[model samples]
Target: MQAFIKEPSKHSHAPDPDRLHIIRLKNEIKLRGTSSAEAPSTILFDVLRSTPLTAAFGLPTNDALLQTISRERPAIQLDHHVRLPLILRQTDRGESFILYEVDSMVIFTCDKNLSGLVFVPVGDVLKAYSSLVNDFDDEDYLLLDYFERV
Candidate 1:
């Protein structure tokens, strides 16, 4: 998937440190476009940018995602467990489903089967587990769709 990165302005003005920093951040994100071999931190950034749903959460290989969330909302502690409503969608297929329940080991998708149950392992969700233990808000959950984009 193509990353929706904004082009930097081509102007020479009084160098504002903050503006330069912002430009650098944008450039860094562009460099880390959706690729096959992605770092855990890049995965987290792409995930958040891909979707508007803010109901996704998981334990990434590193604490980058967690640190960002915590920094954004300090009321939440590091180990707080808050059940997240898993939302899944295939961007290429244009299909969407809501997984109502997420456990320590798996997430139960909206898919129904012979046993009236369909589930995806927690590990498969970008190699992270959704233990319903993450204290993330609806806005914070938008990062979950990064898997489909890549």
Candidate 2:
């Protein structure tokens, strides 16, 4: 059997370094699997501790963050009345997903569903994950297509 190799398109732009970092982090989390004993929230806390953006984001490496995340059911609000619950893990697919809400109404959502990192800007109010996913064509959002190949 031959191992197939895929390459990026010649016309496609180069990947962003920061976005690449985020993708790598997400991949690591997926591979390890996030359980109570090995949750990505803990790993993310550690990563943010060493990251330069830590001071700006004020991400504390503590259980409070995790508690806040768990206090409410994970859901993405698309509009004033529409909200969709998100699964933390897809057991059948062996995929671990996580979402972090950062300052300035920015949200970091990583999942094998999209096979990469997705940054959504909610701007003071929450919105639907699908709304941003639908705007993948827009240039304003930061979307790193780490798994897509040509």
| Number of the top TM-score candidate | 2
lDDT of 2 by residue, 21-117 (tens): 5545444444443333455476556655554552433433446545543443233345443322344323334444434443334333435435323
Candidate 2, residue 58: Cα displacement in angstroms equals 17
Q: Model 1's lDDT to the true fold?
A: 0.41
Q: In model 1, where do residues sit more than 4 Å from their true spots?
A: 1-13, 36-112, 117-150
What is each predicted model's overall lDDT from 0 to 1?
0.41, 0.45
- Residue pairs clashing in model 1 are 47-143, 54-138, 54-141, 55-141, 56-141
The collision pairs in model 2 are 77-127, 77-128, 78-128
Span of ten consecutive residues with least summed lDDT in model 1: 109-118
Candidate with maximal lDDT: 2
RMSD of each: 20.2, 23.8
List ranges where model 2 is wrong by over 4 Å: 1-11, 34-36, 50-150
| Residue-level error in angstroms, candidate 2, position 120 | 55
